[model samples]
Target: MSEQKKKIERLTGVKGMNDILPADAPLWEFFEATVRSLLKSYGYQNIRTPIVEHTQLFTRGIGEVTDIVEKEMYSFTDALNGEKLTLRPENTAAVVRASIEHNLLYDGPKRLWYVGPMFRHERPQRGRYRQFHQVGVEALGFAGPDADAEIIMMCQRLWDDLGLTGIRLEINSLGQADERAAHRRELIAYLEQHADRLDEDGKRRLHTNPLRVLDTKNPAMQELVDNAPRLLDFLGEASLAHFEGLQRLLRENNIPHKINPRLVRGLDYYNLTVFEWVTDQLGSQGTVAGGGRYDPLVEQLGGKPAPSCGWAMGVERILELLKDAQRVPEPDGCDIYVVHQGEPARIRAFIAAERLRDAGLDVILHCSADGGPASFKSQMKRADASGAAYAVIIGDDEVAADNATVKPLRGAQAGDADAAGASQQQSVAFDALAEHLIERMTA
Candidate 1:
């Protein structure tokens, strides 16, 4: 291939991943800021773990037989020490492993939040990517239904803060490990009867985790799942009470939810209170966020059996929902654009722009050297495109008179624009352009 072609190919992002360009930065800022503020209000602290961990950590914490560990992990050996490592497919397991390694569990209950990229080797789809971003929260050491309720409430609060609409919460309890195991046996027996009709993947799931049959996308398998044993029927007394208590809390808080008995999560670690936030805006991949209780996960990863619960939401999926709902806000733009004419005027414009920026206003200083008087119109157009609320024009005439011309780019009616002509420009005494711009922008 030619060098030009090679350069073009190198510029492209890897498949199933994207570069979040300047245009998308504002949306990201809004989403992350809203989530961070909400998490802080709920008394959760931020915790960041490594992007890669020992491969065994996930194998033990997320389950070796599960899709994330068995099929989707991006694992490789470290070049330095030859230790096998894998990019995290999810945060809960890595966070659990961090807690164990650092002995955070001994310090009592901890509420933590994390936001970053997760890698999984999977076919790219509309809402699915090989690499994705997730904002998640983990509440560890609390084992009762109250902790579960708090996590659910936090999610609701996050959605409200983001001004998200038309989302439904579907929740279910998978009961304790033993109860799930008993239910799994009965589910396998049902699958055995329909073995001939089962797809290869479904049959494989039957031998490993028969409960996953209910999570199948196949309509034929779904028919079988509908009549299969419901986990709710097999919940022990304690598990039943825990599920009821969670429902009561939701009622008291006025959080609308539906009890979905077939909502067992795809992960093997989840033992109770698996839930998902779903919307109809996205076609088949409607689940924006979901997680549940994984009480034994920490212990399984060499921790002292610390109970933990958490949830993760896909950033891309949420962005899609926001776009479909027309909820994304317009980007914030420069507050002031400084347009200068002559070389001397350019220096003055730079100084004035600095003053405006120091006063907490965003100022864009134009320093092009090629244009003469004709550049004024082009500079004004650039200022307009910058979405600047105001423009400060400094030309040879203004600089000679030791004055500056400030005009409102927006928030001016037709009459106001006419009244505020060249003569109407604000006259700042000395180098007080910053104060003048601050007052005008705020107004």
Candidate 2:
């Protein structure tokens, strides 16, 4: 290859991964900020865990038979200790493990939220990356249907805040262990009758988790899956009551939802109340967020038996939905731009800029001294391009006079003649420019 092509190859990110450029930062910031604020209002504290954990955590917690543990985990051996570690495919197991390890449950029921990267070895596609981000909430040590209701409401609130419409909430109950065991027996027998027709993956699932056959999206498998026994039919009395209580709570809160019996989530730890938030806009991989009540996950992760229910939304998928609906907000603009014309004015601009920043205003300072008076026009243009609401013009005249011109950086004519006219310009005290910008921006 030519040297230019070789250089270009070295500049690319790995396949299935992407670098979030500056233009995309605002969307991420808005989503995270809105989630944090919403979760805070609902009394959820922030929690963070290591990015990599023992590979066995997922193997046991997410289940060895699941695609995540079996195929998608980025597992590697630690060079120093020869211990095995894997970048987390999801955060639920790690969060539960942290709660147990730290005894975070001692202070009663705990509510926590996390936002970070998650890795999975998958084909890169639109809204699906091997390295993606997730914003999730975990409510540990809570068992009642009310906890489930709270989380569903919180998820709805987040979607609404993002201006996402046409979202469908699908929920299901996987029931307790004993209930699942009975259903598993019946499901296995039913699949066995059609064993010869099963695909390779379906056959493997039949031997491991027969319930997963219902999760298949293959059109050929749909007929067989449609005839399979539904979990709702097999749920015991207690499981039935739990499902009813959740539905009742959702009804009381006026949250519209439909009960989907086939959403047995791609994990073994999930028990009861498996739900997903899907949007029709995104074609095949439409699931934006999905999780369920994992009462056994904490215990499986070496923590004391603590019932927990939570959900994790893929940031990539959510962003796709926003983009499809044209709902993503415009990038934020700077509040004020400080333009200087001379060396003394540049120095004063630097000092004044710091003061404005310390006073909680977003200020951008143009400190070049070579531009002279002619540079003021270009500086003004820069200020306009920065999306600043106001521009502070500082020159030798203003610095010597201990005054500044606070011009509303809008309604500018083509030439400086209109801008230079005293009748068109507004002069404010040099020290009060920050307050003036704040008042104007706020107004």
Candidate 3:
């Protein structure tokens, strides 16, 4: 036998799971920064919860009959202890659980937001992944229809901020629990009459989650589903007034929307106003963001009956749309790069970089992988590729003189770069490097 054992095969990431490469980091950062700013401006506080929660949190909060609990959840027994654990499929339930457990609403209403990864067992597609990121907003202790309207307004503002296009809003109210139950009785009766007309999946959900049957994409079942009983018709007076109030608010704000009777939201906890922003841009799986009032969810999850309204946007789907529409801007690289020659020059380059960074400038220090220094030509190429506007060159001569040669590598055009170098190139002293770079950048 050989003295060395065979190497183990390299393992790959799980299917439907993906790695966010360096190329995609810019867009992710831009999206996150924009959302964080927007949510904060509107009086929302950020909250975080663990990615894994007790499986019962979902089964109880999301509803036992829902598809999330029945099929899509990634649940397993904790190996150390026999406790059942699950990778949260949707975060709303977890958010509600945290709020209830912590009594966040005891002081009054709380406008909270969260951004994190969620897992689900589903077919991996262009915009869907087993491990995906979501930005969720929750407003608790507010029962007014105004709260629902404000949430939609926030959604529209976010789309505008992202410069996204082709998204259209559609809304429908689920009314009170009694109203939905009364409609369910009629809906089931109607579906039972035409049970043979439903698709296999539709038929399966018909008895358990008849509201979801309306969301089916099966062409053969569309005609029947379209003509099925709509919950909008059975709304009580209070429900109608609440729905009208939301409509009036959207109209006043000039936020366009269509009333979609089929928009019940995949979650069973939603009651009263439910809305979704969909786009034809994402192929057949069109919804990009959606949510509504889950008035009973807090109480259902063990809190004193507190009203809540919230929504979540899928990061991948929205990014896909922004990418397709060419709305995401190309990420700019560092503002400056320091390229050096001698060991002493490299040390000086490191000091210059830190000085620039301390001055609020982003700087990239160039180093060759071979442990030997790279030639000036090679360093220049790297500086240009790094998207740095200026390359501060510190050669043996410049290092000995205690100064650096500031070279402009990028400008509006090639000619501009040459012109900038001709006009701005200088041997900047060690202490003046940061000030010199700032002056050149502004100029």
The candidate with the higher TM-score, 1 or 3, is: 3
Between prediction 1 and prediction 2, the one with superior TM-score is 1
Best by lDDT: 3
Candidate 3 overall Cα lDDT vs. reference? 0.91
Q: Write the per-residue lDDT of candidate 2 for residues 184-253, one digit (tens) a residue.
A: 9999999999998788889989979888889988888888888888889988888889889999999998
lDDT of 3 by residue, 1-443 (tens): 66898799999999989999889988899899999999999999999999999999999889888888888999999999999999999899999999989989989999999999999988999899999999999999999999999999999999999898789999999999899999999999999999889889988998889999999888898899889999999999999999999999999999999999988888888999999999998899999999999999998988899989999989999889878978776878899989998888888888888989999999999978898869999988999899988888999999889899987777653335353456446688989988988887888
Which candidate wins on TM-score?
3
lDDT of 1 by residue, 230-336 (tens): 98999999999989999999999999999887787878889878999998878877899998899988878787877889999999988887777677779898888
Instruction: Please report the TM-score between candidate 3 and the true structure.
Output: 0.95
**Model 1 off-target regions past 4 Å?**
1-10, 369-374, 413-424
TM-score of each: 0.92, 0.91, 0.95
Clashing residue pairs for model 3? none
| Residue 330 in candidate 1, Cα distance off native in Å | 1.1
Ranking by lDDT: 3, 2, 1
By TM-score rank, best first, the candidates go: 3, 1, 2
Model 1 error, position 95 (Å):
1.4
